[model samples]
Target: MNKPMFGIDFGTTNTRIAFYDGETVELVKIRNPDSGVDVANIPTQAGFDEKNGNWHFGFDAEGFKQPKDSMKWMLLRDYPVEEISGTESKELVTLFFHHLKAVVAEARADEYEGQELSHAVLSIPVTFSLEERRALCESVEAAGIVVEQIYYEPVSALYAALRENFRQMPIDENLSGRIAVFDWGGGTLDIAIATIRNGFLYILKRDTLLRGGKDFDQIIVEKAMQDLKSKYNRHLDSYIETAYHQKAADLKKTAERIKISLQNRDNFALNYPRFIPKGAVNPPVEEDINLNFPVLKENLRNWIGKDIEQGIELLKECICQTGIPLDDIGLATRCIILAGGTSNLSLIEERLLEEFGTLKFGPLEKIERVPPIETYSSEPRRFFSSDKFGREDDASVATAVGNALLAADGGIPTFTCDIGLIVLSPTGQPYPKRIFQEGSPLPIDKPIIRQLPIINRGQEVISIQIYFQSIGYIKGEFEIHVDVKEHTVEISFHVDRYRILRVSGTGKNYPKRTQQSQDAIMDFPIAFRLPEKLKT
Candidate 1:
């Protein structure tokens, strides 16, 4: 995507913006010329006026705290104009972009010698539904920028972070394999596996679970608040400032802090300066508040990452069903690539190594780490300036960075994904209806499909629904749909050497071919989700 691509990361707690410069991916932020204050990735907190619904975003919204107004949380999905909490998502997005546009306009005049802008890209969560994706496209249009394409956050990271630094991963014929990409973020933990085949990228399998840093924070806060109320033996609701809301907010902050610190330090602290009493406005029982949690080996083993044990197990099941020994994974393809927000965890590498057992699968002899993955902005500013970056630390910002890279890059690779629907014909195919075989190298050979059985003169115009399914991931749970008459279905699929599908059928339909590819309508680009068949 030449002509300058832009990518925006609209997150729950923070937002980031960047553009691909055709060569490099850089984080865009509030960089001052004289003072050299680089405050990028401002917080997502927004302030809304009570009388009117006008909003102030980032620092301006955070700095001005009034009792009459409330801080609004940004909705992070791709759905076309939808609802969040109680607010209209489109309205909220409009306000957010309004603030972002002002910031960009200021930057356009100040930074780039006042060149008028046109194109941009925005990052979206893997869990975003088709509706959500549609809404996001509308919101982008509302923001007055042309969005060329949208990439899943996890895959985008490679284009931005990995490709930006280490471009070499032995592209020769020797090393080829599959990699499990596990990403844990603020609101969700997504796991996906992809393989690069014949210099192309294909997602074999993937899934997203809704439990991340934000969920962890809510857990700690809810638990702490209950404990405090039980111990105090009085109502603390009166002290919403420091007692009710503040604690949850602070606990969320602490939860985030620990999430990062655990990457380096096995232990970190929870800071709370004030302890408000029951029914008292300023009555304080305070000290240098801190609670140290040593996220040691055992602690992490018991931490949220452990929640993904089932997910990993499911992945293993997928791998096992393929009958291809773990050893053959690398030999099956090229090399496994890891990209995502939560992948920053040292435990990630540690855990994968543990799972790989002897570490040599199939013809795969050795695993390699290209370059240390890093985020665009570590300490995202919220209604304020930061003293420094990369020091304060942020981990979940990788997906947005990847989105930026995809936005800048000219072309995205072909995929291993497909869509499925049942064609209710009088009889199933006598042969294996193998327009695409399982695990054949991607950019599936679109066979010139003719001779489709439809009883025309025999009796009446007979129509059949082509059954779409994903193979080898699970025993048999395909996303089913009906392919009506006159609707042509186009398929995207690739199975591995063991006939195990990493990604599966995308059922696209078109009323007429019109020189375009057969199935252009009913396009269902399934999110890269890994069912049980392909895990390990």
Candidate 2:
């Protein structure tokens, strides 16, 4: 009980931390005051030189020409790591914690005056695999922070989200009702839809995509390079290639400002010489910088409009997939909770308003179109930066902080293993059986019994194959060896996120098992509502 608990939220672009002062959670955005990370815009870009094994980070790191390693970005939640490589191997909970420690120590000496770090809670994405979740726990342990708990990113965002933004809006469950999550951020564009459940908190039902606002920024950066090449009219194919690094950085900065402005204004006036986030200086000639003053709200909208519309449609498709009626959701929908950095876009809000916009805007046809602006609306949609959190960093840091909360709960711990044995052919031959699946949830163990009708003193020992699902069918028997003793046999399977699984067994004389019984055999980590294909 004497343990001091703190919340650490490490976001993609920024990091925000807080401590539960035995009461209210205070913002602890302090970096390692002694380290370069203490300065804003520095930690995410830090790099390590392998040759000399040197560490480099901070604002300067952001401006580097080489591909730098991001310590903070290493803790990405919701990844299906089985498909990843490199740092992916470090996805273990222990390894993740190690990275956190470096970040903390960097910040502590820089921010907390080198105080001893203690307990912490963390957050992660809504649908991380059990293994990924386990890795999150490992990160906390690696950080040496006594983990208190772990929670879903969205769930934690809900806990500390800025509420004033969408607390009063009309909500709907049927995606057709159109609640757009225009999440356009640095790494991913995570979009989801909301349906009012009963005038209460907006209950989300479907996701659109993971792409974020950063993609658009990246898109514009590409355009800028192309335009620069066109202007220089270089004969070399690598034309403007050398300028790409600094120019792209400059473009992203301009894009952010333009992006921010497009929400509420008709146009974004790009000044000739803008300061880039990475500190690449670009003093463009008036013609070169070309005041694309009004990237015309419509022009910018058209650029990313398809993505927004697809996002909306994705929600609709998911809602329809849920098999719920549109009216059922609309009428029963309650309040909506819009939490995320990209949700702040005006184009998104304006497009959304056309669908759910109040009569205060007047006339459905005039204010709303079928695809509502079947195109991009003008720039400058009214924005409400949810007042739920006081600090500016609160919005961006909430998800990361929420992930820390998850770490503290001991909620993300488990071992995994694969069970031995397999399904057999009818002729007393062995069929390898797998019992556990990778990334399966916690404390999930299962039992399967097959009775083989045997005559008295039937000497034929029944061999029961225990195995797990593979690309389609059950995988081969475990690489280990086991013996059969009876014709009537029973098998059990067990598993967790960490150990994967451990398979051992006692069995009865089992043979001539029915196809039906074989089909219903349960899998370890048995709790999931498995897909039909995996149910077997």
Top candidate on TM-score is: 1
lDDT of 1 at 315: 56
- The segments of candidate 2 whose C-alpha lies over 4 angstroms from its true place after superposition are 1-4, 8-10, 31-43, 48-53, 58-60, 65-119, 126-140, 145-150, 161-185, 191-208, 234-237, 246-254, 261-297, 358-391, 401-482, 486-536
Which parts of model 1 have CA positions greater than 4 angstroms off?
31-39, 63-87, 107-117, 168-170, 173-175, 233-242, 245-247, 261-305, 308-341, 345-397, 413-454, 457-536
Clashes of each: 51, 112
lDDT of 2 at 314: 60
**TM-score for each prediction?**
0.64, 0.58
Query: Which tens-of-lDDT digit does each residue in 1-536 have in candidate 2?
Result: 22335665544444446543332343443343444243222234433344554434434333333232223334453243222223343333344345445555555533344445566666544344555556656766665766555544454554343222223332232223423333333455444443322222232443436556667766666655555456546442252454455355445656766776776788765543532222322432343233233366787788888877876566445455444565553332222234455656767656655654443132223211111222223211212222423323424554544443333322233212344455344455554544334443454334433333332233433334454443234432322112333434455444432323444333342333222122222323211111111111
- Root-mean-square deviation per candidate: 9.5, 10.7
Per-residue alpha-carbon lDDT of candidate 1 for residues 184-250, written as tens digits (9 for 90 to 100): 6555656556554444445555567766556655555555555555554645445533555544544
